[model samples]
Each structure stands twice: as C-alpha cells, then as structure tokens.
Target chain A: MKKFLSLHSLLSLICLLLVANNIKYLFVFIMSRQKVLNEVYYEPGYQFHTFLPHLKGVEKAGYITDLSVNRESNDGAYLQAQYYLAPTILELEDINYPYFIIDSKNTDFIIRTIKETKARRLANNEYGQALMKRPAP
Target chain B: MITIGYFLSFLLGRLTLDRCLKENVRLLHPCAAALLALVSGLGLSALLTFLTFVVLDSFHRPVIILVNISAIIIFLFFNRNLYIQKTIIPITDWLPWTKFRWFHFLYILLGVFIVGVAYVIALTHPYGEWDAWAIWNLKTRFLIVSDSWNLIFTDLHYHTHPDYPLLLPFINTWIYCFSADNLHPIPMVTNIIFVIGCGGFLCCTLYQIRKFSFPFLMGLIMFTTPSYLYLGTFQYADSLIAFFLLINLYFITMFQKTKDASWLNILGLSLGLTAFVKNEGLLMALILMFVVSVYILIDKNNRVGKSAVKHLLFTFLITFIPVLIFKVFIAPPNDDILPNINTSNFTAERFQILYNAVITEIFHEKWCYMWIVVLALLISRIWRAFNRENIILSIFFIIYSSAIVCIYVLNGKADLSWWLETSLSRILFSLLPALVFFGVHLHYSKQRGAHV
Candidate 1:
C-alpha cells in the first residue's frame, strides 16, 4: 500500500524546499566576499590548543585578571582566546591580580597599565600571558 | 574500575526492566538488543547521576554507590521472571560468517580497516579537537573539584555554555571520582565506545529490518564516512546525540509495526536523553514529537490510542523533568539566543553567507556525502511510492534539516561564516545516521516487498 506524500509529508517537503532556498542565499553572501572567503574559509587549525599551555601561567596565578584589550574586540584570535580560557580564568578570586599577554613591543604599556591600577607586574609566563598582583584593600 | 562500575549500573538497569525490556528484546534481534543495551547503559548511568545530584544534599561517592546497587537489586527482584527465560537466540545463529559470500568478506575487511583508521585518528588527538577540551572536559574538571555543582552554570563559567546538559561531564566526573586521576584516556575511551555504539546500532537495526549482506554494506557506509568517524573521535556531543536519535527512531518504527504502546515509552526515554546530550537535542526532541503526531494522525489502521499518547507524553516529561529543573532552577541564561543573534540583520545578504558556508562544506568537506544521498533518494522514483512505515522517518529528516538551517541563520555576534564553517558539518554529522538509515530502509523495503 503506497501512500505518496500524505498532506503531512507534502507539507514537510515544501518546508524543506523553503529551507534549501534560505541556505542557498546564505552561501551566496559568503561567496560574495571573494577577497576574504579563502582566508576565512581555510583558516588553518584551532588556535585554542596552541594557546592552551601558555594559559597555565594564568591558571597558576589563581586570580581574576583583565585583558589588555576588551573581551568583545573583533580581533579573531583574541576573541577565541577569551572563549577557550574564560571558564578556568573566571574562577580566580584575587581582586588584586590583573593579567594580560604582552610581547616585547607592548611590555612597557602593559606595565604602565598595571601601575595605574595600583598593581605590580609579576614575571611573564613562558607563553607571555601577563600577571599582576594588587596591594591589600 | 569506575568505568566498569558505571557500565554495570547501566547494564543492570536495562536488563532488569520487565516491561520495556521484554518488548525491546522480543521485537529486536539479539544483536540489536546487545547494541541497544550498550546505549541504554549510558542512559541509565546519566539518569542515576541526575537523580543523585537532585535528591541528595551532597554528591558523595558512597551515596551514589548505594543508589546504584539498590536500583539493580530492586529491578532484579521485580524482573525475576525474565531471568528464567525458556529460550535463547544467540547472535551467532543470526549472523553465521561461515556461510558469508565474498562480498560479505569485503564488507568485513573494509569495516575493520575503517574502524582501525578512525581509532588511530582518535589516538592522535586524545582530548578531542576543541569543544571536548573547552566545554565538555572543562565542565568535568569543575564537577571533579567544586563542592558546589551549581558553579558550572554561574556567570563565572559563561564561556562553557553552562545551559547545555551535563550527561557527558557527569559520567566523566563519576569516572574521575573512582580513579582519582585526571588521565585523558578515560574520556577518550568513552568517545570510542560511542563510536562503536553508533556503528553497531546501525548494523544491528538494519539487520533486524532486513537480513542480507545489506546491513554490512550500510555499516561500512557509516564507518567510512569521514565526518562520522572524525566527530566520533572528538569528544563532541554530536556523535552521542546521533546514537540517541538512531535508537529513538528504531523504537519508533518498531512501535509503528507492532502497534505496541510500550515502545512509545522507550521512544520517549530516548528522546529525553537526546535533549540531555546537547542543546540541539532539545530541538530534536520537539521534532520527534511533531513527526510522531503526524504519523499518528495519518495512520489508518491504528490511529494512536488516547492512552498511548498519554503514556508517551507522561514518560517524556518524566525523563525531561530533571533537565527542566536544572535549567530553570540552576543553570544560567543561554548565551546563544540573545546577544549573539541580531534580529535586525536577518536579511537576504546574511542568508547568502549562511548558504555559502553550508553548501561549500557539503561540496568540499571530506565527509557529509550522506546528505547528498538523502537528497537524491528523496526525489528518486522509489521514494515517490512511500512505504507507510517510513512516514515518521521521512518527516523526521525534513524537520531536522529545516531546523538546522534556521538555527545557523539566526546566529548572533559570532561571525556567521566562522560559526558555520566550524559547526555545520558536525551538525550535519549528527543527522547522518538517520539519513543513512532512511536510505537503507527505502532500498530495503523496495527489495524485500514489505517484510518487516
């Protein structure tokens, strides 16, 4: 007994067609960005794992800290860096501790920021994630 | 040792159920029963853990052990008649390799090779690719040390998607509680079992539906599919959700065939567990309800009895209640819905981006050909002559595919392109087994002429 597309199945098929069209338009938009499509599409491997070992320094500090940049910044790597590390980082309770990663280029600016916050820079972690400790309240 | 104890709890819970167990065991072939049992083992383990977390003021190891043992004893006492079974049907009798054809041997060799390759890949990246470490395993760490379980859902743990269900992490925590070690292999082994569970469930269900070398061929298709293997190795919830979805569909079909309402309860239980696996699972649960309702209305011979529908609804609630309490009472707000989505940006251009990411992945991704196969089969002449048995399955496929596209399109602050690129394939992977099962059933029904 073949029951071809009872109204239920027919409606389902129509719904699927509408969804496919919706998907097609989304593809068109991405392809429209010919310049950065390849870069964004072929972005190599996950950056989180590479950044994982460096975050261990932050973990050892046992204190909540601020990043040099805002958490919601559009920078690709930094955005995901926060995404991957925030859970472990947020558990830190030391209000005096502030942290940010610094390279040779920005070390002075970061140290200045730490000073302004009435904190002192601790040793940089191997991965360069920064740590700061605040004076007692 | 922890894995063994948890596994035993699941086995006992499943084996000692008189009503659901009898119907499931009787309807399914022995091989299917064993595979489904493995999946049910996880279901029981998660349910017990959830109960312990909710009932007791604290999650002490001793209390959990006592609960587990007590459950087994009570279920065993109630199901004494089952242990006194008069007949036995060994799986060997069902699949006699001695009589296999050459192609059968080919299927076996290929299955082994594919599984071996997948295992090697799993070993290469033991902690799972990304989500496993960031979200699932991170939550496990919290559960391991935190005296307060509610901390996981706090704003402090916002990045971990605290609103998502905790079955995987809770089981991992249980393992850690016993071993007192943070070894990576324990979680890796759990993922491997899920991989095997997916493959085994697929083959056994196909065999139960129609016996031939066909089940082997379908199993090979599932095993060799790059995305299926890849995600299975990664400690992602996608594979676990897929396993739960398959078991749900299998039982639903059995219910359709036998008109036995008891199977609906089993179906409800599986659907509830699916919701606990991931947030996407909640959507899947809704789809199951919608699809089954349509099937009931369209069914001519046995329109769903009122009591049957009541039982289905009640059991689904019973299974979902713990998660509901966790969400409403304990977990933090879901970040995916708000702050992420820009309702104002829902435009044609945005949709174009969503389509490009999804279609490109479908074409270029090493895995995900099953979706194409499903699309092809839907339009084929064979599909036009709908076997009534597949009504629920067809509806399920349509609803799931539609729902996924809608969800991706509605993304908030995350770059749509990046989000789609990273997740679209895994989302598709979750539905792969069901798609493959649909294909197998279609060709199978056509070949055998309505045997099942």
Candidate 2:
C-alpha cells in the first residue's frame, strides 16, 4: 500500500481526477460538433479571396456588413477588418443599409436570411459579398 | 517531399550534434527520437521560412519550397562529418508486448482513451477556438493566397494581429501547399501535430531519464492541464511556444547533467524557435541569455567559463538572427501595448490591483492546477531547489515571471483588468511545461538522492 502513494501514483491520482472532468469537455464538443444548421448555394462570381488587394469594393458596398459565420456567431474580425483594412467611404445615410460578406462555407440560415431580405447577391464562389435591399427599420 | 526534408534535416542535425544522441544513437529509443524529430522538423521549417522571406521579397510557394529543400541539403553537407551507421533502438524498446504487466495495460488503455477524447475535442471545433481562425489560420489564408504575404504586414485591421510572428502561418502555408491547397483540415491537423509533439516530448524525455511509469504520469499531468490541452487543440501559438520552451529546458538540463556542449546547440535552436513562435518568446529568449551568461560567469573554472560564455553567445547569435530580421524588416508595430505611459499612474493601488488579479488567477483552483502543482513542488523542495545547478533555472523562472508582470503593468492596453483576466492564464500556460519540468526534477532528485 505504501507503494501506491509513490510520486507517480499520487500524480496519476490527480490526473484521474482531471480526466474525470473530460466528460464535461466531451459533452461540449459533442453538442457543438455540427456547426452548419442550414444549406445554401454560392451567389456566383465568388472566386476565392486570393488577397484583399484593395478595399475599394468593400468601401463602395457600405459599412457595417455582417461577416463570416461559424454556427451561431458572427465573425468578429469582419467589423475590425472593415474599419482598419477597408474603411467605407459611402454616404452616411447608406451606413444603415444591411449587407453581408459571407464565408464560402455559408449556412442555410445566412443564405435564407439574405433571400428573405431580397438582398442583391453580388459575388458568391468561395468568399461571398451581398447587399441587402432593405435596411432594418 | 519538401516537408519530409525538413524532418530529415533536423534528425541529421540532432544525431550529428547532440552528444546524448551521438553517444547513444544505437541505444536511443524510438519514441524519444520521434518527439525530437517533430520539434526539430517544425523548428527548421520556421527557420527556413523566415530565412527565405528575408532573402527574397516574394512569397511564392515554389520559391519557398526550393529554399527549404536547399537549406536541408546545405545543413546535411555542413554536418556530413558527424554522420555514422548507428542503428536506432527498435520499436520493441517503446512497445515491449512480451512483458504483460497489469499497470502497463492500464497505462496503455488510459493513453488511448485520452487521445481519443482529445481528438474528438479537436474535431468538435473544426476551425479551432477563436484565435486559431481569427489569428493563426487567418494568417495562413493570407500566406497561401497568391500575392497576400504583403497583406500580412499591411495596415489592415490589426485584428489579424499583424505584428505577431509568422512561424505558424508559414508552416500552415507549407502544409496547405503540400496538401494542394486543401485548406479545411490542414490547420486543424497541424495543431494536432503540435499537441502530439508537446505531449510526446514531455513523456519521452522524462522516460529516458526516469523510466516509464512516472514519466507517463507526468505526460498525463501535462496533457490533463486544461489550458494546455484546450489551447493545443485550439491552434494557439501558446501551445507551440510551450513545446519549444520545454524542449529548450530539456536540452539545458541535459547539458547540466552531461556537461555536453553539443546540448547547447539544441538549447539554442529550441530557444530561438521559441522566439519565432511568439512575441513573449522573444522576452523568454532574452531572459535565458542573460541568465545563462550569468551562470557561465559565476563558475569557478575561469578558462572553461570564458569559453562556455563565448560558445553560448555564438549559439544565441546564430539562432536569433532570423528572429532579428523578422522583427526589424517585417512585422508591423505592436498595437497591444499602450502608446505612452504615465509615470505617475504607477501607484500602489495599481500595483495591488494588478498583483492581486495575477495571483488570484494563477493560484485559483479552477483550470490552473499546473501552477498549484508547481507551487506545491517548490514548497516541498525549497531546500533542495537552492542548489548550484538549480540556481540558474530558478533565476530564469523568477526573472521571466517578473518580466511578464512588468509587461502587464507598464504596457497594458486601456482595458487593463480585462486583458489581465483573459490573457494572463493563457500566457502563463505557455510556461506550464517548465513548471512541470521543475516538479519532475524535484521528484527525481528525491527519489534518486541526487541533484537534478
């Protein structure tokens, strides 16, 4: 029994306790494993973003567009990228116009939302860009 | 083929230079060699990428791959004299199925379960945690795209962390190119390799010194550290940096044990790679240099001390030059730090707040058992830890922790409390391997009645 409390055993006991916690972690992973809740198609002319050589296009489209989505949340970098990398120069009144730059791997919800809003689909091969016809009132 | 070349170059380099490997190359265990190969392979790839970027203005895949292959050839040529026909230890050394111990079966069983769970955890978030996609893999997207390496350094929204080091990005790019631009799983797979490498190195290296059971448990200790496991799967550079730092200490400890100067090269390479992996790595590298120099200078043998210092300086210079180029010629100004500091703001209240937050975060019972284990080991081994050999290691840890605290105090952004709360644990997690190393050594020293 004295051998049971050797350094390795003692440490292994702590590790056993830790591994017991993996059940919670495993549940989290299993719960969120399927990220795509809907199906959608590309908007056409969406060649993969080779690079953002210029922000003129994003600027012309307007500010505050919804960016990429992974499951339920919007990609936070979308706004930061808009602000720092490609600041919009559109009229202030147009700022309220809804738009989205979807990731190539778009969920049906995002596409359905776009279709519901009757947004003009601009580009949609790999990386997508869309402009909503109606702004949120 | 080019990816394999990076692993080969590291194997050749270590087998040639590392005295531990050289002397025992025949008896050298397979798992240990594999772990070393993984670390060295990633290190060489990062080094080659950094060098290629420095030499050429372009970031084309053909050119980068060519440079990596050429570097491998050149490395082998330079170290050709050290090559030998020694055979590595057989697979049976690692997996001796003939011996049927109940504990061994349990160990193997537990290992498989843990690995399966970790893989599932990794698969759960295909893109990895937030920063993996936002920062590291996002940079990979830039690098893999034609003519986008420039965008990495562009004033584009700093959300990509433009000032961050490019090792992970470049590596992901290499893998992406090799996989024919199959972008989806490569980054995730790369992160899994890092997790495997970190855990494998910890287990294998400890097993080499202390034998199987304890080291296996130690690996479990490291793997079970929530932050280490979580971040490793998340594609964060913190796990990669921890791997490099751990291996760096492993080599240093080997040098301490064997008085083998060749171990210093491995130490230098690992530390240099650590710096290339993250900005905090740069801080850790500098602390190591200062601490090592002091260690060399304080030894009684003046002639050996002077020679050792010179050798260490050369190693550091050779290893760190790429990081110097990347920092100087590339990388945008870091936006994380406050632009200006008010000397008057360094009040007792500010100190208390910062100190209290860090201490609470570090010592708290949830998700930070690594730090608690480290504290417990230190408390138990206080008298033994004050020996000559551990003095340098102790100084390195003290100065490194203090440097981190100072960085938080003086240069933290506007939201100091939030930054400390969110990042302090992750940053501390990068040093978890070192903390575990100390605990391992303390235990071994007591067990063997020898100074580790």
Candidate 3:
C-alpha cells in the first residue's frame, strides 16, 4: 500500500534526516497552534528571488548552502566575488562583479577543501560563480 | 569512489558510442569507439565528484533527502537484476565508433556549425536570460578548481535553485584541465557541445523512429526552437539535462520491449546523469522509474523482482548521500523559503489563502491555453493506443508529459504566471521534442506529408 512513497521517500527521509541533522527546508512550517519542542531553521528571512526568471542562471538562489575549493598553485589560487548590498543570497549575481573579490580566510581551509566546489557554484556554470577556490596560474 | 564514477561514466559513454556506431556502422572506425568510450567514461565519473557542492550548495543534503529516497523507491518498484556487464543492446549499444561514412562527418559538422554560430553571438551579446550568466556558466568558472565549498553561501543566499544534476561543468573541466588553463568562455564551448549533441541525437532518434524526413523536420524544429537555442548558447543546465533526457528516453524505449539488462544500466546511468544535471530532474526521473517499475512488476516471469532491492539501495545511497551530507550536516539551513513555511509576515492562514488564490487565479488563468491544448492532444493519442505507434506515442504522451506537469505542479515555484509565460513552456519544452517526435512518427504511418 505504501508503494515506498515514490522517489521522494528518500527526500522525506532526508527531510526527516534534515531535522535530525539540524538542517532546514523552506517547506517546514507550523502544522498547528502547538509549537514543536525543537525545529531546524529554514531561514525565514529569504524571499522568493524576484530576478530568478530574468537571471536565468539557476532554479533558485540560496538553494545551495556551502562551498569549498582548492587549487594546487598560488597564482591560480585567487578568487573573484561580488557580494550584494542587502545580502539575501539571491542578489549575488546583481552585485558589481569584476567589482569584488573573496577568498577563504585560511590557506589550511583552502588545502583541506582542495577541488571541492559548492554545489550551487557547480550548477551555475563557470563564470557565474562569485566565490571561488583556485590554483596558481 | 572516483574510479568507480569514472568506470561507470566511461561504460555509459561506451554504450552511447556503440549505439551511435551501430546507427552508422559504415562511418565508424573501431578506434573511434575507444575514443568515445574514453571521453564518455572519464567525462561522467569526473562529473560526479566535480558535482560535490560545486554546483549546488546543499548538494549532499538535498540529494540524500530528495534524490536517494526517490531512487530507492524506483529500485524497489522496478526490482529486477542481472549482470549488467554481460549484456548489451546491439542497436543501442555495441557500436563501432572507428568506422563511419563521410555523411556522418558532414552531419556532425552541420551540428557544430549551428551551435558554433549561436555561441559566437552569445560571446558578444552577453544577452542572456540573467540565470545563464548569473547562475550556471558563471558559477561553473568559480567552481572549476574551487577549494572552499562555504563561499557559495556568502554570495547566493536564497534567490535561485542551483542544484541541477548535469555533468556539463565537469565536461568543461575536462577540457580546461586538458588545456591546463582557465579561460573565459571555456565553459561556453562545453555548453555548445551540449546543445549540438541534443540536436544531433534528436535527429538520430527521429531517423530511427520514422526515417530521414521526420528526423529532418525534428532537427529543424529543435534548431529553431526559440528559448532553447539561446538557453543553449550560454552555460545553463537545461541543454545538458535535455541531452540526458534524450538518451534516457531512448534507452527506456529500447529496454522496455527487449528486456535488455544494459538498458536498465542505461536507465540507472541516465537517471544519475539527470539528477546530476538538475534537481528537478530527480523528480521527473523518479516518476518515470515508478512507471517502469509498474511495468516490470507485471512482467510474466517476475524477472525483475529479485534484484530490484539491491539496486534500489545502491542507487539511493549513491545518489542521496552527497546531497544529505551537504544540506543537513555540514552547512544546515541558513536561508531560503519553503512552500509550506510561513515566511510571509502574514499569519499561517495566509498560506492557504495564498495557495488557494494561486491555484485559482494564476494556475487556472486563461492565457495559458497552450499547455492545455498540448495536454489534450497528448491524451487523445493515449486514448487511441491500439497499434505499435499508438502504444509508443501513448507512453511518451501520458507518462513523460504528465511527469513534468506533475512535478511543476508539486514543486510550484513563485510567480506562477511568469513561470507559465517564460519557464513552464521550457519545462514543457523538454518533453515537447520527444512528444513531437513521437507524434510525427505516428502521424506519418497513416498520412502523406513529409515532416522533415
């Protein structure tokens, strides 16, 4: 009768795991007046990206949550970024790029994350990535 | 894990290459087979590790919660097992790439020409739907040799969903790695290949189904399809997704009646590739898996039942682990509004009220007649599936199209009207090519016109 809940079974499982893992999804909500004892935070502040359609870069902003990259060389190890004025994640693209730069604060952090790119950056393609990890050119 | 991924992608590539060879045996050489195998295999495996949060911030997380569980369900439903290494789909696999006719070369050139010219324009115009420049290709450059997975959060907090599951970036990385350089627009070239591959594959599919004329028509339609062409020029996940979809659908069709184990591997392989390309792809793939599983369940021999569980588990663990690790454990939820959540300042009741309004006002709006018309036509075909054409068309019509609509409905994005105007059609666009190809082939059996 369950039919294993379709492909989303793992999604629901992952959702359950998210609660277990202390992560959050946009879909979690107060089902009733009684508040649960504990809940993961699905950043309540993030709004629907207004420019998502026009942006044409991804399905949604902030869909990704972390990034880690490492390059073998020093000259290639620089990164370029453009943070937004309001800083809600969605506006990363709108920020003056070629206008900003961002890099990991520590080289150790860089070494540990060598070749690891954020899931979000991977989807957006090469030029779209704002934050970066690199090797010396 | 890297080696396994490479082995799988390479095998899959070999299968695809072999299929290509069989289609034009006269044009292929044996060495070409090895080359294609090498490219495809290495391309796919590297694709997996490269997707490690490089594309989606919560890659490991969403995949676990979303894709893995779905894969499990699919595996359970379509439970069948055989040694995949032993069997092959000759028509769709075992192709000799080394031999080919001059015409095959000519056609490949034609495809290159079309994609090349379009890409040249994109280079100067930079006239992209911001998503392409902002989300996919631009992001690809950043992720190529990334060392920090956390930096993605600082920039794109919660505007777009960047969790598509395609391997285009890795493909580009492969090229970039080969050149030992990171140049602007390098990713653009990969995007071009993705588009051209889709066009060429579509043409080949039509040729297989109906003959040269239908392929010609389908090729023209794809080459000229408006939003698709532009989407192709810049680095977006759609073209890659489309490519995977095409191959997946073809293999599914090939595997269904024949019961070739290789087809199942291709199915799993494609599903993996699709999930890699776009987050939405997993949903569609899961739905199709359900359909396939149902079909498998009714098999008289009960052939698929025994092995389904193991494959299902492996698939889930393989696909979902990365996403789960990312979203739940490492980064957790720092941003984004979910559908059910009361993100609005308004009370919780507002969601229902809003949901009702969106459903009634936006989804049911009058201007969205195209989808309705298309849906009706597809249904008509399904209702009349008495012959070979009828059955095939019916499956693609009802199953494939419905799967997409179902996902779009379930995962309703904000700005429903705009989605309908700009994006829904593209969602529909993914299935349209397959459906239209089916329609044309079916129609030609009884009619007198040359579609190509």
Please tell me which predicted candidate would have the highest lDDT against the true structure. Answer: 1
lDDT (tens digit, per residue) of candidate 3 on A39-91: 33221111222222333433223221123321211121111121111122333
Which scores better on lDDT, 2 or 3? 2
> Which runs in model 2 stand beyond 4 Å of their true positions?
A1-137, B1-21, B24-29, B77-112, B146-148, B212-216, B301-305, B359-370, B446-452
Question: What's the TM for chain B in candidate 2?
Answer: 0.86
Candidate 2 collision pairs: A38-A108, A46-A125
Q: Which DockQ-derived CAPRI band holds candidate 2?
A: incorrect
Share of real interface contacts recovered by each model? 0.03, 0.11, 0.07
Per-model TM-score of chain B: 0.88, 0.86, 0.64
lDDT of 2 by residue, B1-452 (tens): 33553455455445433332444433334555656665666666667765666666546667766766676676566544444432433324333456556876665676576667567667656666666766776666656543436656763456557888878877766655456534667766677777766776677666655554554566656676555666678778887788777777766666666565656656676666777888888878888878777776776743344566666667677768888877887887787654635555567776887889878987775554656666776687777665665766777788888767666677634556766766777787777777777767755654543323
Docking class of 3: incorrect
Per-residue error (Å), model 3, residue B266:
1.5
lDDT tens digits, residue span B337-385, model 3: 2453333334444345444543453234231232343344345455345
Using alpha carbons, what is the TM-score of model 1? 0.78
Q: What does candidate 2 score in Cα RMSD to the true structure?
A: 7.2
TM-score, one value per model: 0.78, 0.77, 0.54
Model 1 deviation from the true structure expressed as Cα RMSD, one decimal place: 8.7
Q: Which stretches of candidate 1 lie over 4 Å from their true place?
A: A1-105, A117-124, B16-18, B56-59, B85-115, B209-212, B338-343, B368-371, B381-387, B446-452
